[model samples]
Each structure stands twice: as structure tokens, then as C-alpha cells.
Target: MSKRFSKIAAGIMMMAILVAITFTPVKAQDDNQNADLWQVYETTFKSAKYVDLTHAFSPTIAVWPGFGNATFRATTAGADLPGYINEGETYTYADHGFIATAYELPTDQYGTQLDPPGHWNEYGATISDLPATYAIRPLVVVDVHEQVAADPGYHATVADIEAWEAEHGRIPEGSVVMIRSDWHKRWSEVERFNQKPFPGVSLPALQFLHLERNILFHGHEPLDTDTTPTLEGEYWLLHNNYAQAEGVANLDQVPEAGALVAIGFAKPEGGTGGYARYIAICPPDWPNGVSVVEVPGAPLPVQPYPLRRDENGVLRPTPPES
Candidate 1:
């Protein structure tokens, strides 16, 4: 057999292993045992915690306006596989036969999905072209629940971001910012979450983060970044140069700062955005100081940032340092 084939077989075997590995974070067993506030926080925080930020997708889950519903079908089951044996009233499959399925996904935009530049720019970076590091970053939450509660179409403005900085300090240089409007609470019901009017980051907010703060990524509770298209008109902020997470939820569980988020998704070649699973990792206790502060306190070190899409819309990432 060819060396390549042998290596492939070995790799597959390693992935097929079903070893169970569980990691338990540090946590206080008893809080009422005469512990102080810090002690309680410490014990609770000692072990790290994780929160699921991805929305669950299903036939009943909400979809973008005018989009089609997802349909799942099992192509082949144990009884249908070749070499199957039939008993008196039951059926058994050969050891090699197993359940098989196929998906005719119309687009990857359904459910919780990533929005790489390719989603907008024809020559933009595709999912495969994105660096692995992009998936992980410090998590920052901007809560606009007050305004959202007042107005369903309230757009997060520059003032909102400035307020966040006022309390938490300037957003970290490479943090993944999430906008929360408490919309995730309506996830169980489709229309309430997807069809009803919602709030999201405004153009000015996106500009401040992308141009000035230089955040690693941005996310929102709604299906789209530009929620008020009639007033905002055209999703230039998302389509022009930035990649964001859409249909994200559970921001209420995350804090204003100090958490870390990791996004995992499949990379389908020649595809746009697709289903994704994003998780936020929270340390037992919030850090003593702000999660990240640079502008007023200290200047951030220079790091390679991807240059804006060229005139032709092709992304040109910076070269690695020597």
C-alpha cells in the first residue's frame, strides 16, 4: 500500500477512539461555611466555567425572512445497508454496515453561523483562509438591554460603546465583542426571536471597533448585524471589511469583560458562512483589574493586522515578523 494511504488509515483510527476525558473546574463546595465575599467569589471562580453562545438550529427554529426551512432525511439506516440480515421480525446489519446520511444544504447561513469577509466580498477570505487564532479571543459584552427594552429597533450607538469604555475601560485590541439585547430569551419561539424587530450594532459602533479599537471580531444576538435596514440602509459595516458572528445568544450569561470565547465551525471549501458552535469561557471570578486596558493606561504593542480588502476586494494579511 502507498505510504500516503497507510498514514491516512492511521489518522482515521486515532479519530475513531472513544476515550472519555472530562475536565472539572475548581469550585467551592460549601459557600455557607462562614466564607467572605471574596472567598465565595474565589471558590465559585476557582474552576473555570463555559457558556454556550451558539443558538440551537432545528426545523422549527427561526430563519431569515423568505428563507426556506431545513429538512433532514436519513439516507441509509442499519436495516437498509447492504449485507443486512433479516430475522423473524427484526433486522441486523453486517459489522461494516452502519447508518449513513447526506445533507443538501442550500446555504451555510442558517442557524448560528460565522461571517467571514467572503460572505460579502467576492475575493474576501474564505473560512479555510481564516487563521485558527481567529476562533479564540477575550470576550467583551456590551449590554444595551435598557434601550432595547424601550425600543425594539434601538441601534447601539457610539455613546453606548463610550459608556462601556467608561466603566470597563477601552475595549481590548483583539477582543471578541458581543452585543446583547436580551433577545436570546425568545429563542424557543421562532417569530419572537427572528421575525420581530431587533436592535444591533450601528455603523458608527462597528467603525469605532474596527478602525479605532481594532477588535478581533464582533457578534450580536440578532440574525443580522444591521438590524434596522430601513434606517441603516445597506449592511456596509459587515459587508465591507469585517467578519462577525451572527445569531449569537446567551450574552446575558456572559460578563462585561474578562471571559474568553472560542468559535468552532466546519470549513466547507467554496462556501460562504455555515453553522457554527461558539462557547464563552469565564474564570470563576472576574479579574481584579479591567480585562484589557490600553489606550489611556498604556499603548498596545504593534501586531500584524490584516490589511483591508484591496480595491479588487481580495484580502491581504500582513506578513509574519522576522
Candidate 2:
């Protein structure tokens, strides 16, 4: 038989072993479990679909300037290339094929990552300090794709936020307002991803979202809160003010509103930021429908929208102080 055929056969044999080893866990039922509770748990998400808003982490994934790359090195494999197995050991027929990989996780902020308050402020909240419930909250996507397509160095201004509110009805409090710049499409190649200056939140726009609207956090398709050109010595936007999710993808697929976003990641101690699994849990009948009126549990009182709306039903900006 040809060497290629032998390698394929070895791969199939190894896969079968891996499948058996990765069986689902069988956890015991809870003490106060009712049949309805079990049924509800089982059926609640039976028809739900999630949108992957995260970039797959890899050595090929785009890296921020002055950062390292994530890598995975196969330690052992079915193919008899170099050191497939022990020098004298031969392939086994049973489900015990030895295979492993050595990995470099890059920095915590590699690929798609979330920046908590502490990333900027010395005494600010870390990933662990953030409330567990904040992981899953409302999503408000404001598309700036067209504007950025026209001008590579665009900065989403306060007018952009106001315009979004005009249609979406005053971005409700505790929402994660994402600036959809469609930047992720170029993430495969570092050169293309960094080709232009890229868009970012203008100071007033950020102040509107964080201070006036009281959102949970802000997010973007780009790698940082500040535009590439403006990401200079002092990271003003990221320092101790707004939490952020950077290098996110697929925002173009998710709707502008009426969706719940779930961000999952391991909370590393003293972490500035880390890779996150960003998911958009949209309504089953979304795009055709609107945002949920109220979140199930007593609408999270994180930061209720304090500003009032205008005669046109838009959120009026906080008046400039004398």
C-alpha cells in the first residue's frame, strides 16, 4: 500500500479512540429536582442557535502590534513521520493511540479577548471581579461598515450613537453596544487587517455610551478601543473606564438589537485581558422581531438610562454643564 493510504488508516484508527475517550458526562440529578424543572431545562434551548462572534485562536490569527502569536505543535500523531510513537513501539489496533500537542497560548489578550476595567486602572475590577451575570446581557450593534468602507480612518462620533437610538429607542441600560466595522473580515492576514488606520469610538461617543447610557461595556470588530493611529503611548479608552471585547467577528450576521450576548472565558487571576468565547444568542424569530421588553430576572439594575429622550423619541444628550 502507498504511504498516504497507510497514514489515512492510522488517522482513522486514532480518531476512533478519541471519540470513545470524549464521551458525555453523566451527572446525578439535583436534590430538589422536579420533572417540570428537568423538562424546562431540556427544552428551553432545544431550538436555539448561537452566532460565533469570536475569532478562532491560532498562530495564523491576527496579532496586535508588539504581541506574540498563539501556536499548537503536535507532540504525537498517528502518522509515522518522525517521532510518532516511542522509537521501538509500533501502532496499536485497540483504542489507545497516543496523541498529544504542545501549545503556546500567546498572551491573555491574544485573538478574540475581553478587557475588564483593571486592564487600564491599577485598582480597577479584574475579570474575576466582574459580576457573573454580566457575561450574558443585551446586545446593541451599531453598524459603521459603510462609513468605514468610505474612510479607513473614520471615528464613530456621538452622532452615530444618537442615530442608532433614534431607531432602536434609546439603547437600554446595561447593554453591550458593539461598533460593527466589519474589520474581522480581514483578520486572516495581518497585513490586510492592519492595512488602514481602522475606525474607533470618538471621545464623546464613548462618554455617551459609558457615562450617559450606562452600558455594561463596549465592543468592536477591531483589536483595540482606540484606532490604530491613535493607539499611542496612553491607552485613554481602555484605562479603568469601559470594559471591552476586541477582535470580534460575525457581527454583520447578528442584528442591531433584540439579542442577548454571552461572553465566556476562564477568569485568570490578575489578568489584564484574556481570550473569550463571544457568542450572540439571538431571538429565534429575530430580524423580523424586536428586542425583548424585559430580561427574565428583575431587569438588571446595573445602570439605568438616566438621560431623557427628545420630542422625536430619541435619547437627548446630557446638557453641557456651565
Candidate 3:
């Protein structure tokens, strides 16, 4: 009878403890900041036109001669699968469930790239060290193509930037400024593309952009900042812990203002350079690019022609219905 009484008391105590726990108050969270951002994506981003400001790099694309060409081939299985295949066999869709390509990239600097300060400064930030806040920013394009057409060795000056500001108001703080020289037109001519006498950004123009206006970074169509004897512009930027974009393309398609840039890059550990993709998000009325609502790619469309491996080991699309 005493043992039964003790068990009943213990059970009552446990019930009281549970009741206290159930009544404890938690702080009320009324903020819907995430929902607000979702609304922005649905309204502004979904309707915006996106232009690819990046170049598709290939084995034959213009690269610094010191770094060799990249190679592509079918990925081979390293070990035998119990029921699927043997060791040292190349995986193909017909045999393995899917096909994968193995890329032998020689250097991270071979393509349209984001060059971190560590590319030149030993103690500076690497590619992975870049912050998530760098994902998007206002885009500013300064047209210097006419100057470049007149002189291939043209380097943009502070006056040019001032002229742009006078006409289009001050460049926004933390915006990305691209010096458009129409230099990407020579991309198909490998030797000519990398040759000297290419358009570049002058040191003064770069200084005004970052130091005075406080821009996030500046980009140019050419691979280097300038063909100057010492590349002083690039040297100063990296030493001062700034990043810049190289080998950017399609600037003529994007507007000079009222646009934003979506910055994306590969974050290899301790990488000095990043293979970057820059996309310009234009206003809905822009005629150049497609909107997210137009090409909502949850399930991507099928190709008109099947891909076939070419003699160069790169895959090419076959002729349709032939």
C-alpha cells in the first residue's frame, strides 16, 4: 500500500513538470524578412531579362601561353561495380546510366575569371575567401569602344570616367564597372586576342573607380588590365586587396545603367583565380535577353540533335534528322 502511494506521488510530480514545460513562453517572431525576399524574387527577378556576360572557355580558347591547353574526355570507372561493369571501363549512357566528362584543366586562369588579391599578393584573400555579399551588385558599363577602335593600345583615363559620371550621374557605391572596348570581338582569333596593343584600363581610371567612387570592382574585355610595361594598374589593385574581372564579354548587349550583375564563381580551396560567370539582369523592357518566367528550367528542354564525340575528344551536336 505504501509503495503504491509513492508511485502515485511520483506520477503526479511528473505531470506537474510536464505542465510547467508546456506553459513556458517562447519569444514571438513576427518578422517575415525571408518572405519579403521571396516576393522580390517573384516580382522583380522573375520578370527581369538576364544576359550572359561570360565567354564559354574551351581547350582552344585564348589562354596565356605559359599555361597549356585543357583537355576533355569520357570519365572512366576506377573500380569494378558488382553487377554493372569491370574496372578501367569508360562510362557511357548506354552502358552505365549516365555519361560524365572528365576535364583536365591546366590552369584556373584560362577563362573568364575573377582574380583575387592572392593572385599577386601572397598574404591576400583567395577565391574561396570572397564573401557571400559579393553575389549581386549594380552594373555600370562605360563605353570606350570608339577610343579603342581608334587606337588598339588605348587605356581608359580618369577623364573618361568623369565624362560618364557627368552624363549618367555618379557611379553607385559598390557597383561593378565594366570598361567596354569591343575587344571580345577578337576572341575567335587566338593569337590576335592575346597579342599586345589591346585596350586596357589606365591606373588613374582604376584608382578613381575603387578609391573615389568605392566600386566593388572593374572589369575589362581583354585578359589583362593593360599592356603597360609593368601592368601597374593590376599590380596596385591586388596589392591594395581588390578583385577584378578579366575576359568579360557581351558588354554591348547590356545597358549602361539600370541593371544588376549576378556574380558566380568556382571556389576551389586556396585558389588564386576563379573561373567566374557574370550575368546581367536587365529591366523587364530590355529586348536582348530572356526572363526567368520565359525559361523556367525546372526540367530543361531536350536538344534537337544528339551529341557525338568529335575527333578532338570534344562532344559536338550531330546533324538533325540526317
Candidate 4:
């Protein structure tokens, strides 16, 4: 025995260097556990619970069609003044300076003498009096022209959102897929919610939710979400493709997918959609008592309210009394 075969070849070279230092730290801890399972599935679906589309801008809201001509008044007593307020009492700040007005319903007899009534056209062509920084985002009403008037041109596609993501599973990328169509309960008589022709989202469902599901936003429920005499008669699909960059019109109080939406844009610095105040955050684990005629299915015909059960049972949001 040549010294017992050199002590079994030095014990098989120290067990092959301890199996290469134990699989090099088990392949770097299996790639940090697959990047921590996609960071815990994007932090548990973005802390799940927030679904409010948006829609509330009163003065009998509802707009679109050269958009404008809604007013709110209360001015007199020293009327319209923008000076004298260093110490007040100039008729108590002109008797409570309350001047709210909007216009654009002009297009005939020389545009109604260039919009009379205390004279103030501010540029006047109307698209809802243009300047709220160009209405960039906030007006979420999400669908309701009497439930799409029996589906004439019936919008909402991408194979209806891939059949709602193969029956509710995918749709979670920044999520804001509102489309309620409750055309603001007929926006208080504006030729039946702005010159008829409601129902939205067509254009291959707005380029399949803005270029194949990158959806960070999208909105509907009248007030223009692209489907009027648009696309050629004035090209306006939220100002034609920023891919609905921050779109939202009047989502009649959102509820087609749970709820939680909060917009408050008054940015005004390069502006393009200012004056926003849209909130909706309900989630105590929702499902409280449930009533709104027992929300099962086939009753989402747009929503302007109808989902009762309060006495601590929860399921709130009830606004339909018109």
C-alpha cells in the first residue's frame, strides 16, 4: 500500500472543496428568491382597496359638444370689483364678491353678440369654457347613457377587456379602468346629456387600454371620452392620444370595480387640467350588509346611486333623487 494510497488521495481532495462552497451560496439564494416574488406581488396589489372613478362638478354638470354654457350666479351690490380689499369694508368686499359664470353656447346671431350677460367671453369658443388648464384630468363619470341605449354602437372592447381578464384576474397595473356610462343622470337637460350619442371606449377600446394594457388611467360616463361626432369632425379623444395620459371625465361616482380614487389637481403651472376634487375611498373590508337591490349582476346600468344598507352595515353611496 503506497502509504495507503496517499491517504485516500487526501480524502478526495477535501470533498471537492466542499462541493464548490456549497453551490456558491445556493445560486445567490436562488436569485434573492425570485426577486422576492416580484416584491410580494407588487406590495400586495398596491395595498389593495381604492376604487373611485370620479364625477362631481355641479352647476348641473354634464358637458361635451363645443362644451360650455353652465352658470352659477350671486353678484350685485357694488358688483364685480377686483380692487380695494386691504382692510375691507368697501361695501364689505363688494357685498361678498361671488361671481361664477361660464359660457360658449353661442354660434349664430354673431355668437350672441359675443356672449352678453355682464360681458365676459374670455376667448369664447367653448369646449366647456376651455381653461381649467385645458381640463386634463377630473370628470370621471364612467358610463350611463341609459345603459348605453340598448347597445347601438356599444363601446368597451379589447374583447371586452379580454373578457374582463379571463374573468377577473389580471387588470391590476396601476388600474383605473372606469367606464360607467351613466351619462350623469342626463346632466339636467342639455339635449339629453349633451346632444345625444352616448356610450364610450371605442377606438379598439382606446387602443386596447392605451397601447396594450399599460393602463394607468382611462375614463368615461359622458362629458366626452371620444364618441361623439368626433375623430374627424374635430379630433378629440381627450385631445387625441397622450394615450389618455390622465383622462377622467365624470365617472358617476365610480363602482364598477370596488372603489378608491382621489384627484385634486389645481396645479396651474403650465397647467392642462386644473380644478379637481374627486374622492372615493371606502374599504373597511367592504361588503357591508349589501342592498342596492342586492347587487348581484346585470344591474350596473351606469350608476348614479342605488346600493343602500347603512345602519353600520356599510355599503353606502346612495344618490339618485334628481
Candidate 5:
């Protein structure tokens, strides 16, 4: 075989092996026993690196202008509960021995989100209708940061996907493909982050990933899919009963291939959008994330200062000392 053909063949074989290792559960010695998955947890997962891809949402994070900012306040007692506290009284840690927060979220489309089809289509599946199989999938990160750097409004194209395949082989079926633009670095700077010319994914790229490769879904760093006059890319995705992720962060820390994405979301019944969390599980030697073995996490670390409500009503460490 030609050298190029031989290289391509090897790449394909490696991807197939990676897919098998990721999805297929190990068999147990005894068929009736439930130790198979336990073994996988003890062996594979324990040694893998984990990267958080979700951005924590708060009142300050940028949102679509149409959707107003969210509010956070201490949860108050209700009259009908028949408790010691009266209605409209705020609960406090000193008096009630516990404190709770109440969030006044204006929309489900806030922050990192999984946009279900129902967000646009009348007969499409809502957040709660998503299947359990959506829990985990192979992760593919197509880096377009250089293009985005040259052109802030750059939208990834089918050629980008083809180029990625040229190096990483075919994107796995049922995988979650994240378009990496490094736009998320601007997340803290709300105005700049939401400006007119942010990085995005083109409609053709989205179609290729879903129609040709059959990826579970495509995610991007920007909230919207493209900077087209009509946002046709996002419109086409949702109206066609396909879901996509937005406001995803930390793509630079993950590999181009050979990683798994753990998908999680708040399942509000019949909800149009999802408050989503995506975590990337990478190979142990990737060099940027914490491994399960590195941080067992059974007993989480405690902050030096106690949590107290801030001026914005969000809980923050008191005194703000480093």
C-alpha cells in the first residue's frame, strides 16, 4: 500500500479501537453478576483526565439581549407550610440553621445550554424528552482558533471538518463534536464576548457533522451558531428537530479526538432549553486536567472563609482574601 494510504488506514484503525474502548462495557467473569461496569470504573475511568466544559451561569454572565438578567436571593418561608417562620421572611443560617437560595431565572436559554428542538419547532422534543443514551459519547474537537483569530466573525466550514478528518480520521458516529474557536476566553468580558463578530459554525459544517457523520450533536463556544443576518445555522438546526450546545467553554484543554464527553442537563419537564454541563474525559497524559486517581474527591476541600451573601445576592467567600 502507498505510504499515505497506509497512514490513513492506521488512523482509521486507531479510531475504531478508541470507540470500542469508550462505548463497549467490559464483560464480567459471570454473566449474572453486575461487576462489569464496576470493573470499567475501577480500571479505565479511574485513570482518565477530566476537563470541565461548562461555564457556570450567573446574573453577570452574558445572555441574549431579549432575555433579561437572572436574579438570586435567599429563599423565604411560605405561609402554608405551617412552620415557625412567617411568609415573606427571608431564611438565615443563624436563625433557621440553614440557608437556601432562590433563583429567578428569566429564561432557560441562559449560559451554557443544550438547545432542544422545541425551542423552535412546535412538535419537537423538549429537554425532558431527551433519551438516557445521551449521557456519554465520543468527543471530537475541531480547532478553528487560527481562522477565528484572523477573522473574528469566522464561521467554520465543511473544509474545516475535512481537514480535521485528514489528520484525525473520520469523526466517530454518535459523537459530540465541539467547534473550538477559543472565543470562550472572552466570556468574562460580556460586551466583547457578545459583540457582532464572534466566532461561529457554518451551516454546511453543521450539516456535514450531522447528516454525513451522524454526530450526536455539535457544540460551539458562541451562544449562536453563526453571524449570518438571520442566524440561519441555528434556525436550521432547531427547526429540523436537531439539538445543539451553546456557551460551551474550555475546548482548548481537550484533545482533537480520543476523548469522551459526559453530557448532563437540568430536566425541566417540557422545557424548551436545557441548563447543560459537558465534561471532557481525556487520556491520562493530556497534561491539563485532574484525574480521578489524582483527586479522589470523596472529601471535597473547604474554603478558608465561610460563604456569605454578596451585594448581588450570590453566595461568595467572605472578606475576599487570597
Candidate 6:
């Protein structure tokens, strides 16, 4: 009987030890999980405000050269008097009788032929049509417009990035660095946006971002990242050097940093540059990695309209002249 009691006591003691060991790890794991959750929450709740970088889209909106102008007008009448019935006299109508009314809404104009084509032949869509799969990457905004305007000699050179890094910290790896010249500021006037002389990324800048930094992609708000007049340096960077090798344009929608961008493609199948819904994903805090996918501020790309004047003292698009 004593022996039996000893065996039972030992079994009970072993069970208690096992329970204590198991419970401690479970408690520790719970504590770790709670800590992670708190970190995410704090990061999210802090970064609530988002800066809008995209210019508004409208017929009056400024566009680059070659792109069409925007236009809108009523296309159909909403109500009309009946031909068979008099207006003053009421006529009895049978049950199930029907009346028709027509109304028209204005169509949105994209731009002219001089405008940048919506899609590239290789990508099969415009920069806007980038898929959700691409959204996971980090976004970097390179002030190409401001930088170039400030210093015409400025190129995306090592010195330029080093200067920027000195001010903003290291450029995060595997991120998209957008060049913002506030070039979109010209959206309201075509000549101002496209014709205005301004310096763009120099070849050095292109090489630095592409080969040296191995940036995922580079984009600019301007029609092209390089300067106009087709300088040999610029040509070598884009066509000859193909430094961008693979990059995008019109990155005005992305924030300088701490933003996730998703480009929704039109999926035109075998077409160059399909229309896209450009979206920005910002975290709640500055940089904790929780994203709030925001809707795009710009309208979808479309064709341009003819210019016209409206009765309300507004400039509008008229039918194109033959």
C-alpha cells in the first residue's frame, strides 16, 4: 500500500512540472504577441495625415504639349413637350403607359496628341496601370523638379543623393524614388507645363539611381525625366545607356517617402500604356509599415476635347475644327 501511494505521488508531481513548463512558454508567447500588436498600433495611429501631391484633373487643367485639352458639355435634352398632346390640357393615360426623358452629362477630356502616350509598348499599359502586386514596395520621392529648378547643373548624381541623404537620411533600399518638380503645377496651362525651360535629371543622376542604387524604379512629374533639346548626355542616359533600363514616369502621386503606391492597370491586353488608377498607401505613423491604401486624386486618362467658351463665363471645349 505504501509503494502504491509513492507511485501515485510521483505521477502527480511529474504532471505538475509539465504543466508549469508548458504554461510559462505560453505566457511568454502571449506577452510577445501583445508587444508586437502594440508596436503596430502605435505606428499606425501616429501617421494619419497624408500630403496630396497630385494636381486636380479637369478640362481646364494644364497638360503637357501634344496631349489633348479637356472638354465637357451637355449632349442631350432632359425633357421635351409632346407633339400629340397639348401642354395646357391633360390627357388620360392607361396603366403601364411610359414617358421618356433624356439627359446628358459632360465627358472628360484627357489631352492632345502631343501629350505623353498613356502606355509603353513593353509594359503593355501606362504607368498608372501598375498592378497590386507592385504595391508591396516602398516609395521614394526624389525632388527632381525642385532640385533641377534650384540647381540646373543638378543631375541624379552621387553628390545629389548624398546631399539629399544628408538632409533626409539614407535612401531606403528597394524603394521607388519619385522626382517631383511640381511640374504638375503647370497642369492648368499647357505652355507653362511643357514649354517652360527647366533642367531635368542629368545622366549621372540616372546612372546613380539605376546602376549604383539599384532602385526599383524611378519616375518624374515632368513629361520626361531628362532635359529637352535632346542633348547627347540625355540621349545616352535614356536610349543609349538605357540607364533606366526599366523605370516609370508621372510619380507625382507618391509622397517623398513613407508611402506605398499601387498602380491599377487597364489591362488592354497587348497595348502600350493602358490607363491606370494611381493609388497611394500611407502608414498611420511615419514609418512603422502599416499601410492605408488611399484612393487616387487624379482622374483616369482620356482623350482631349476641343476648346470653347461657355455662357457661365467659363472656358470650355468645343467640337474639334476640321
lDDT of 6 by residue, 1-322 (tens): 2443244334434434544544566667576553443444344423333443334344554444355544443223234456654443332223214332222213111321111123322322333443456544456666656565676444455666666666555666666666656555555555555554644566677677767776755555554455546554434443432322112334554445555555433344443332333445554433323333442335744437843446432345566768
Candidate numbers, best TM-score first, in rank order: 5, 3, 2, 1, 6, 4
Better of 1 and 5 by lDDT: 5
TM-score of each: 0.67, 0.68, 0.87, 0.24, 0.90, 0.51
Model 6 TM-score is: 0.51
Query: lDDT values of the candidates?
Result: 0.67, 0.67, 0.86, 0.41, 0.87, 0.46
Give the residue spans of candidate 3 off by over 4 A: 1-35, 320-322
Compared with the true structure, what per-residue lDDT tens digits does model 4 show for residues 1-322? Answer: 2343243334323333443443567677565554443443343223333343334443344444454443433222344445533332233223443332222322211100111111112322322233333222222223334447676345665666675555444554545566665554555565666454655676776666656665645655454445556443113333333323122433543333434455444432333333344444322233332322344346556655765434432334687667
- Candidate 3, poorest ten consecutive residues by summed lDDT: 26-35
User: Candidate 6 local accuracy as lDDT?
Assistant: 0.46
**Clash counts for all predictions:** 2, 1, 0, 30, 0, 32
Give the best candidate by TM-score. Answer: 5
Residue range 240-274, candidate 2, lDDT tens digits: 35678888899998877666688897788878886
Q: Cα deviation in Å at residue 88, candidate 2?
A: 16
lDDT of 1: 0.67
Among these predicted structures, which one has the highest lDDT?
A: 5
Candidate 1: tens digits of C-alpha lDDT, residues 1-322:
3454344334323322311111122243242333444443343323446678887675557777677666544343434434553322232134433433334565778888888778777877777777888766778899998899999878788898888888666788888888888877777877677764777778888888888999987888778776664534125654665678888888888767656787898888866786889888665343222222212325655547744333333334556567
Model 6 error, position 204 (Å): 2.2
Candidate 6 Cα outliers beyond 4 Å, as residue runs: 1-47, 70-131, 144-156, 167-170, 231-256, 274-322
